[model samples]
Target chain A: MNPLLRVEKLEVVYGRAITSIQGISLEAHKGEIVALLGTNGAGKSTTLRAISGFLGLDDARVTEGAIHFKDNSLANRPPYLITKLGIVLVPERDKVFPNLSVVENLSAPVATAGANRKRLEEMAFTFFPKLAELRGRTAGLLSGGERQMLALASALVCGPELLLVDELSLGLAPVVVEDLAQRLVEIRDKLGITILLVEQNATVALSIADRGYVLENGRVVLDGDAARLKSHGDIQEFYLGGAGERRSYRDVKQYRRSRRWYG
Target chain B: MQLAINIAVLTAIYALIACGYVLIYRVSRVLNLAHGELMMLSAYLLITTASLFSKTPFIALGAAIFLSLCVGVLVYLFLMRRMTGEMVLAAVLTTVALGVLLRGLVVLIWSAQQQNPAQALGWVNHSLPVFGGRISAAGAALIATTALVYVGLFLFLRFSRYGIRMRAAGQNPLLAAQRGISLHVIYALAWGLSTLTGALAGILISLDSGLDSTMVLIGLKAFPAALVGGLDSLVGALLGSLIIAAAEVLMIYYVDALLSDVVPFLVLILMLVFRPWGLFGTREELDRV
Candidate 1:
């Protein structure tokens, strides 16, 4: 089957001296979740922003690249046009209109997208029942988890075919992260929509992703099945802690000692 | 009793002009400082059109409104569209330039003379009894016009889909675009409505007094109306105008005549000191970068 989305040699240069991402290529198939795992300062979010057309063309220029969304070229299109073409990006920083209520936030995409306003709203509410209960509450009053849920609901309200979720688990509690991850899996399973999740949380991303790519210093260092990558020696040593040996209560103390020595 | 009627008439006129200023400012977030100039120009246009046509008063009024809408749209497309971003100061200054240009253009066309169109429009008549004293026909017409404009604005904003979209665009342009509402179309509509309001206010003012270049200064009165009402609130504009007008009238009668001019400035200063967001504006709007 043809890939739902394709990025060919995507190079994003921040300035004259700083190259954020260099020669990165990836493909995401329909009805699958592809996680882009990376450390801090990795080009994961940069790649996502470039695809969504949020970053400035002149400053953080896409020096050499082409992005294909369902066979349509999206390299030079404006952000709104890209959204119209059925690709929605839930930005990293949860850019919700602070003063507007939850209902207004959900209704905003309807006003802009102009299709499936009713059905998509119902679908969003189903995925996030908490949102349905607090539809009248202003977005400013929502907690961190609720805000993330609202952001996700707002993006889904647009009824995007391909959802590019950036930093879904960022700055949330562990329990909240797990809940979000479960919801993402349930969404993919039930809705048959494609997802490209860019995240810094290696474990949580790999836990839900069908396939994962490890980005280091703006280049893809590893790409394989999620299950295999989870068990990979280097991944276990650095990211997952160890294979078949979870960090126990006593092991946590020893790990802290090693971490301090390494530091 | 005569003083009371005079104060009521003045309050109604001030409220009408304030409403128009607030409407345009709410949607576009740009202070059309030339708004007063637009009012003056439309009044002049109405006078010229009435003299040239010698037609029915209703037809002449229709022609004036049509002309003002056209001028408003032209201003948006030619001037306002070119001014964007943090250069709101530049945008305001450009409007000031437009005001000067408008005043100069009117002077050249009409020879800088004050002309009365109320006689031609058949508004000149004997005074009608109000509480215990009498009010002139023109003063009554101004109040009637204000009521008509208010009801029209209320229905347009509350029921019309485009009107709702315009309000949405004003509140958040990016979000509005996400739902396929073009900011340009909304801006044009806002300009059209704003011009319509200004023209109507100008006609009403001309009926009360004669039309002159100094009529443009009436727009300045709207600045205080906007400030007192809260720049973003239509209701605020109406209330603010009433307060300012009543205060001005009362000050002229009871305090000092000069206080009528100074009152709006005093209200503005007080608002700036305590509630810089005006009466209805949010903190976010005031802190917008």
Candidate 2:
């Protein structure tokens, strides 16, 4: 099956000087949860920014490479236009409007026309029942986990065909992250919406993702099935913190520099 | 009783104009320094419109108000739109430049003469007895308009989908865009609404007094009220306007009449020094401004 979203050799540059993402490519097939795993500065967020059409806000641009969703080229499209095209991004932070109540936040999304907005809102509550109880509370006052849930629920109200989530587990406890990860899977299964989840938490991402890509130094260094990646020695040593003879600090960069695989 | 009436009229003027500042500031975070010029321009438009719609005075008033709204949107589309994502200071400086340009343009077109829109429209500004104090027809209108605008704005912002989206956009523009809300549309709507409220203030004030470049000073005076109330809060604007108006009227009555012009600024300076965020503005709003 053709991928629902495709990033072809995506190259992103920030403020005309910094090449934050260079020749990075990835894809997510329909109804699949594809995790783009990376550490800090691995260009995970930049790739997401490029796909979501918000690169211009930060003086970043897609210098080369094309991002295609279904057949629409995303370059030069505004963020709202990208969203109207059914690609909605749930950013890691500042995801919810702080002053708006939970109910208002859910209604704020300019969802696709003909979509049953009321039903979607109801479905959001069904998925994250905690949000229903806090519907009247201002989003700013909500706990971090509740805020994340609100953010996710609000994103769902957009009726996206493709969801781009940046740093889903950041600043959350292990239990909350796990529950959120499970909710992501449930959302994909029920809605059949393709998801591109960027994360530094390989364990949580791989646990739910069907396919995974590991990015390092603005390049995709590894790609594989989630199960196989879980068993991969390099993934174990570096990403999952698996047991291994500790490599010397000086040789660590050399070890990472030589890492590569294809799944 | 008369002093109370005077305070009400003055507060009405300030609240109406102050909302223009608050609307634009809350949405796009741009301090529209050109608001005074725009308000003055609206009053001037009434003069031209009064000539065109001479047979229908109400029609002329409506045309002038509508024209002002169009000008506000045009300013955004033609000038302010280009400044988006550039820098906040750059956008604000552009407004200052806009104000200077408008000041010259109004003079060039209208010839620096005092024009009475009420007379041109053939309307009488009669004073009526109210609660043992007299209030001009225009003064009463200003008070009514201010109350309606505030009530209308409160409902629109609280209950309307566009209003919710507007607040959402103001709070987090990037996220708002990601949710399919067009920032340009929201910003443009803000400009249009802000200018509309400013136009109402200008036209009513012009009807009460007369019009010239000096009318811009009224818009300028309204800014301190907005700041005192908290630039983001409508309730703050009304309270700030009341506080400023009361101070000015009392100072004029007790101290020197010349002090009336200086009192608003004095209150503003004191507010800035003691509580820069205004009465209800968020603490971190200082950084955003």
Candidate 3:
């Protein structure tokens, strides 16, 4: 069966000369949680931006590449058009409208054509019960975790078939991140929605993701099933931080040298 | 009692015009300095249409109002569209330049002479007594129109889906755009609504008094009401209009008559000095402006 979303050799460039990401390809089948893992400046966000149609705002564009959603080309389209096509991105920052009440934030997004808005809103409340309690509260006043929940819930109200999440655990406590991770799995399993999660925290991302890709310097350097990636030697050394060895300081230096050689 | 009536009349006039300022400024963060000139241009449209459709006064008035709304949309599509993504100061200056161009165009088309639409339409301007205070027919109509416009606007912004999107756009335009809300459509709608309200003010004022370049000053004066209330808040505009109008009317009665022209600005300055966001405006609005 064909993948739900396919991005073939996508290349994103900032302004005209600065290439942020090049030859990046990935896929997510329906009902799959695909984690795009990367450290800072790994171009994970840029990939998501390209897919979600937000690159235009930053003078960025897909200089070379194609993004297909449900077999439809979404190359260089406006963000709203991409959104209407069932892809929604919950941005890392300014995730919620600060001044709007929680209810208003949910109501603000233009749901997909033929979407049952009332049911979607009810589903959002069910996924994030904390949001229901703060329905009347201004989004800016909510706690960090609550704000993230609101952002996720609002995105859900858009009736997205593919949800692109950027840095889901950016500033949240581990416990909060864990709960959010569980909810993400629940969302994918219960709603049958595909998720492309871009995260720096590999442990959290792999814990829920069905498959994962590790991006470094705008390239997908490693990709495999979540369990395979979790047990990979390179991932174990660098990401999971020494899988089973108490290495010496000399050994740590050797590992850094090896990373540079491989990178 | 007489003073109260004067204040009410003046407040109605200011509120009607001030909302135009709030609507545009709130949505785009650009102060439309050309509003006064646009209002006068509409009133002049009334004059041209009044003669064309002299027999049907309502048709002439409606045609002029409709034309004014079109002009606003055109302004956004042609003029302001280019200024999008440019500096806010550039957009504001564009309006200033637009105001100058419109002022010149109005004079060239209609001439500088003051023309009365009431006379052109063969309508009589009669002084009517209300609550022991005298008001012209146009003044009463202005008061009623202002109330209806405010209530309608309040409901539209609060309950309408488009209104929610507009507010959403105002707060975070990128997010709004990402959520499938068209920024251009929202901005254009805002400009259209603003000009409609401003045109209503101009049409009524010209119907009551006369239409000329001086009518632009009325539009300019009402801007302070919008500012004093908050550039983004409609409720603030209404309350600001009342405050500015009361101050102007009282100053004219108890102080110098010439002070009427300056009182609104004086009150505006005081409000700006203490609270740049106005009474009901979100505090971040000041930073955005």
Evaluated with DockQ, which candidate comes out highest? 2
For model 1 chain B, the run of ten residues with the poorest summed lDDT: B173-182
Question: Model 1: residues >4 Å from true position, as ranges?
Answer: A11-24, A54-64, A110-114, A215-225, A232-263, B1-4, B48-53, B82-87, B120-126, B133-168, B175-181, B287-289
**Native RMSD of candidate 2 (Å):** 1.7
* TM-scores for the candidates: 0.82, 0.97, 0.93
lDDT score at residue B14, model 3, on the 0-100 scale = 96
Local accuracy of candidate 3 as per-residue lDDT tens digits, A178-209? 99999999999899999999998888998999
> For each candidate, what's the DockQ?
0.20, 0.77, 0.57
Candidate 1 per-residue lDDT over residues B191-222, each given as its tens digit? 88888888988987887788888887777876
Q: For model 2, what is the alpha-carbon lDDT of residue A119? A: 93
Estimate, for each residue in B1-289, the C-alpha lDDT of model 3 and write its tens digit: 8888888889999999999999988887889999999999999999999999999999999999999999999999999987654567889999999999999999999999989999999999999987888988999899999999999999888788888888888877778877877788899999999999999999999999897899889999999999888888898999999999999998888889989888988998898889988988878777854
Order the candidate numbers by lDDT, best to worst.
Answer: 2, 3, 1
Better of 1 and 3 by lDDT: 3
